[model samples]
Target: MKPEQLQASGRRTLEIERDAFAGLLERVDAHFAEACTLMLGCHGRVVVTGMGKSGHIGGKIAATLASTGTPAFFVHPGEASHGDLGMITPQDVVIAISYSGETAEVLTILPLIKRMATPLIAMTGKPASTLARIADVHLDVSVAKEACPLNLAPTASTTATLAMGDALAVALLEARGFTSEDFALSHPGGSLGRRLLLRIQDLMHTGDRLPRVAPGTPLTAALLEMTQKGLGMTAIVDADDRVVGVYTDGDLRRSLEDQIDLRSATIDQVMTRGGKNARPDWLAAEAVQLMEKHKITALLVTDDQLHLQGVIHMHDLLRAGVV
Candidate 1:
């Protein structure tokens, strides 16, 4: 086949899958609602099971559900029959996926599932098939035809199944009032989690590493502290250790423009007073917002009493993946 022919065939395949998904959307009815309700009301985890191509879609659906505030995991139907069924409890809800609705391994476990009185939700192309007939809720994911030219591959049907699974996850997420913070908790090591859940306290330079100078400290001394701390700035504090001002690279530039004597000038004389600051408890993501809003690179972290706690640079947030 020519390269152009291959491209054409691939595009047609995608078009078929896209239309199949649209068909599934139009077919969604009260059964989809009932499926969502069953999963939402489930006190235990959602145990997803399937075979073959449907199994791959089931794994992805389980992951999406788990990450979106629904506790869920995938279990291969064949494995479920061989003691993996122990993972399923009476309190849990079972979501079974099979394009034909009569996959042997899947059907083999239906009796055991029913005997446990576990709520069964089936995603299938044939509503009248045995799996659908026995399910407490049936989500119809039927497609007009397979995307394969031969009409044998599970292409369009699998696409429809995955789309339906996403719809159910999103609906349950909304009904449960699942927030981004909740999502972050489930994905603490991912970039989104870092951006949503990381706080200034987790990334700030604190204690002795926090560059600070007394209000009357000489500019030369403050510059030394900033250099030693490598924070590009130093917080100027009063005798009470309360933040009084900040001296940054910008201040150094202005001082040079004015030919201010670094030896004689004190931090209070040349520092920017009452500059923007953040609380240690503030989200690092929020700190990035503040810094971008002010077009600044660093911020002083303070406690409720306005006492200097630490300092955070934009670089810190970038390294922490909050950017």
Candidate 2:
């Protein structure tokens, strides 16, 4: 086939899917709201079930719901007939998906699901099909046409189904007041979790690894501490171990320009007073933002009372993938 023909085929697929999505949006109505309400009010998990291609879409919907604060799981309709129906509880909400609303595997378990009296939400292209008639709520995810040229493949219909599932998940997420922190808890291993939930206390250098010295210590001694700790900076603390100021390589350069004798000058005289500081509980990503805003490489972690707790450097954040 010619390249132009291949391009035309791809364009046709996109146009079909786009129109299908537009149709879904136009069909959104009270049924969608009823489905959301049923799932939100459910005391137990949302049990999603489908057969064949619908099963794949149901699996993704379950995952999206679970991650977005709606507790949900997928059960294959075929398996449900073979005893997996036990997973469904009366307190739970059941979502059944079938483009035709008459998949044999799914329809076979409808009686058992009804016997349990679980709230049923049916997603189907046919609004007047048997499944829709029996379900407590019917969400119409109908598409005008299939993306495939032959009009037989599950293309545009599945896309519409998936988008509708996302709409439910996001709507429920907002209704539940789910925050970024809540999302981070569900995705602790991901980069977004690290950026939102990981704190300075979790990544900062603490205890002996923290570069610190008495305020009156010689500038030369503070430099040695900075070099030994490898943080490129040292916290100048008072007798009570409260940070009074900070000395960094930047201060050392300025002191040299002023021709101050490092061996004789005290840390209190050379240190930058009231330098940027963060709380141990502050998010590491926030600390990174602060550092970038001030164009500094290090920040002393302190408590509300200004007691030194730890030190965070750009290197530490970079190593932790917060940078």
Candidate 3:
């Protein structure tokens, strides 16, 4: 095809797929809710199975369900008949996808699934097909036409099926009140998980790693503690280790401008009293918020009695992937 024809073909394909997705809106009726109910009430996993192109979509649908708080896994229909059928238990719910609704492999396993008394939800374009007729709930994913000019490729139909699967996952997600924290727990390696699940205690410098000094300590001693610990600041605590203030690089800059005697002045005289602080249990993201709010780069972690627990710096958050 020529350049213009190529562009036109791409646009035409998108238009067909867009309409295919739009058609699924009205179809998200009672049957869709029933499918969600079945999967929600499932004591075991939601087993999805299909053949060919539908199998690919089934795999993605199963993944979405699993990540969004509904435990699910994809079992290829072709493999199910061979031996994978054992994976589906009586307590499990099965979601079978087949636009044609008569995939021989899928049909071959229906009798066994029926014998186990497992609830079956079928997504098909043909409501009269055997898969749909026998399904406990049939989800109509019919598309007006394929995006393929020859009308043979599984294009728009698959798009509709995928959207329907998303609808079910999201509805069930909300029904279960799945929160971002729950999602983070499942995706702990991802950035969102790092932000939501990483606590300040996980990254803060504790024990001797903390830079601390008594309130009466000279400015030179506090500066030495800051340099030795390399946290860009040092916590000023009382004899009992209760944090009273903090001395930061910014404070040093101000003291230099006033020409204060760094050698003779006490830390309590120049330190920022009751500096911004965070609890050890706070989310590292919350520490980022406190740092941003105060326009500072470091914070002291304290316990209920304001006792110094640990210290966190901007670099710590950056290294922890929580910034």
Quick one: best TM-score, which candidate?
A: 3
Compared with the true structure, what per-residue lDDT tens digits does model 3 show for residues 1-323? 89999999999999999999988899999998999899989999999999999999999999999999999999998888889999999999999999999999999999999999999999999999999999999999999999999999999999999999999999999999999988998999998999999999999999999999997888998899999999999999998999899999999999999999988999989999998999999999999999999899999999989999999999999998987
> Which candidate order results from sorting by TM-score in descending order?
3, 1, 2
TM-score of 3: 0.95
Scored by lDDT, model 2 comes in at 0.92
| lDDT per residue as tens, model 2, 27-133 | 67888898999998999999999998999999999999999999999999998899999999999999999999989999999998899999999999998999999
lDDT sort, best first: 3, 1, 2
Worst 10 residues of 2 by lDDT: 22-31
Q: Evaluate residue 199 in candidate 3 and report its C-alpha lDDT on the 0 to 100 scale.
A: 93
What pairs collide in candidate 3?
Answer: none
| Model 3 bad stretches (over 4 Å) | 1-6
* Model 1: lDDT of residue 213: 92
TM-score, per-candidate, Cα-based = 0.95, 0.94, 0.95
Per-model C-alpha RMSD: 1.6, 1.7, 1.5
> In candidate 2, which residue pairs clash?
none
Query: Under the 3 Å rule for N, CA and C atoms, how many clashes does model 1 have?
Result: 0
* Quality of model 3 by C-alpha lDDT: 0.95
